[model samples]
Target: MRAKRCVYVVTAVLPLFLLGPARPAPAADEPFPAGRDRFSSPAADERFPAGRDRSWPLPGRPAVLRPWAPPPTPHARGHRGVDLAAPPHSPVLAVASGRVSFAGRVAGRGVVSVDLSGTGVPPLRTTYEPVRASVREGDEVTAGRPLGTLEPTVSHCPTTCLHWGLRRGRTYLDPLTLLPPWLLHPGSPVLLPVLGVPLPPPA
Candidate 1:
């Protein structure tokens, strides 16, 4: 009887000790492991500091009414960049520091492109369209630098909006990903603890 009682206690007590304390599990949408930034990426950090090059093309950080929608293929129909709601002739700003590769007309629509060659591989480029060029080609510009003014021209949005784009060679990337967390509405991530079998109650 004594040996049997001891066996039961040992089984129960050992399980409690091994079970350890309960903690929240990692959320499904958590981007980082624990202490890292939610939108941090090593590749982005190497090119553009986390959230560094993310200024709205329009003044006052205008709302992005239409988001980026990349096409399945290069020729397929798709929205390459984000469409920020802005008034006609609104000042357009550069999202990052770079040289103006092109600041001229394309298909009757004024366009501006900044070459981000110093930042990353495949030579990234940021383009703003339907904008009257204020800076000339080969001019160096900094973040928030006035590139041009929004011009009323062709746009994917129903209303007047600045079409902001990012590209790596032939591939177009979502410009919002380059923006800071504060500029976006990626909501708080939930953390859940790793689940293990529940330990039996202590005898």
Candidate 2:
């Protein structure tokens, strides 16, 4: 019982200990340099949009069902974000290190939003929807941390899909741009017939 209590203490305090003051917003004209990771060093990462290709397999190798289509004008009819098809109840994850800004139900769907540190004046935010949250607002999370599980209900896509949105202030941007080119354009993957099969004891 004492050991169990100690484990809980560690879990609770670790996050607080790791959380740092949010990095300062970048200058208006200085743009994010090419070839930099959005979650990399504070000096280089600022001014870029948030998220990463590291989430390529989020919730289990999700496929892009709908691409981000920016509207010609705000309030115009256009898809605001990309939608990725994944099985219901699959675990959702944060694509980069950030602080949770929101985690709860909106309307009838679950949503989670994280403010990426050092993005800009408003700070770039990444959002996910149809997710039943496991993290809470103000919680600090690292890249690839599990934030929740995909909710069973979905509406944006014909099939179950996770809607990923990213924005700075009121303007939405391409979430994929945050990724380095190599990852964004990785060539088609080689097929593997079987996976996770352990070899028999070496002889």
Candidate 3:
């Protein structure tokens, strides 16, 4: 698929304001350990630091309608990523700084893939699907930069939604692991003194 290379220089920057409110993620097409809740943090997610480099892929951090459920084998039936509830044409932003590796279609659905900078070896690549891309392949994009808008078409969910995926080479992982707690599990918006607000006790 040799398409023309196009560059997109983003002039307008978006503030990290999303952490709005998304419905709690629900386990889809699989069963979890009997005692655990669907949203329970897995051990793999504990290693990630709450770094500033990451941001929500969508405004308001849309509801994760379908959580990642990996298959025992690659060819088995399972969701490779997550399905986030979104409206048609909502902007889909980058989760981190990266170069757009591929911005095209797959199985009749628009898709975008980004190879993240600084991640070791085969760099972590984030993917967004059912999106009509505004940025083209090889373009460098910053976190929160618009990659495209969710296409107004049939979605895997009952309503329109965006499929968000992340991978390191051939391995699949939870996309939510990239988000910091504040953005992944934000409380109601609040205002406090920036100078010297009292800190909450250490967890």
Clashes of each: 6, 0, 0
Summarize candidate 1's per-residue lDDT along 4-82 as a digit string, tens digits: 6666557655654365345332122212223311222224333355645566677776876666654433344455677
lDDT, candidate 2, 57-174, per-residue tens: 2744566777665444433445666778888988888877789999999999999999877666788899999899999999998778899998887566789888887777665676
By lDDT, the best candidate is 3
Q: Pairing residues by index, what is the TM-score of model 2?
A: 0.64
Q: Which 10 successive residues of model 3 have the least lDDT summed?
A: 4-13
lDDT of 3 by residue, 1-203 (tens): 11211111111111224434555545546433333222322354333445787778899768877888765543444677888898999999999998999999999999999998877768878999899999999999999999999998764788999989887776667888888887876785554323333433433
Q: TM-score of the candidate numbered 3?
A: 0.69
- Candidate 1 Cα outliers beyond 4 Å, as residue runs: 1-47, 51-53, 73-75, 185-203
Misplaced by over 4 Å in model 2 are 1-54, 57-61, 187-203
The local distance difference test score of each candidate is 0.70, 0.68, 0.75
**In candidate 1, how many Å is residue 120 off?**
2.3
Residue 36 CA displacement from its true place in model 3, Å: 30
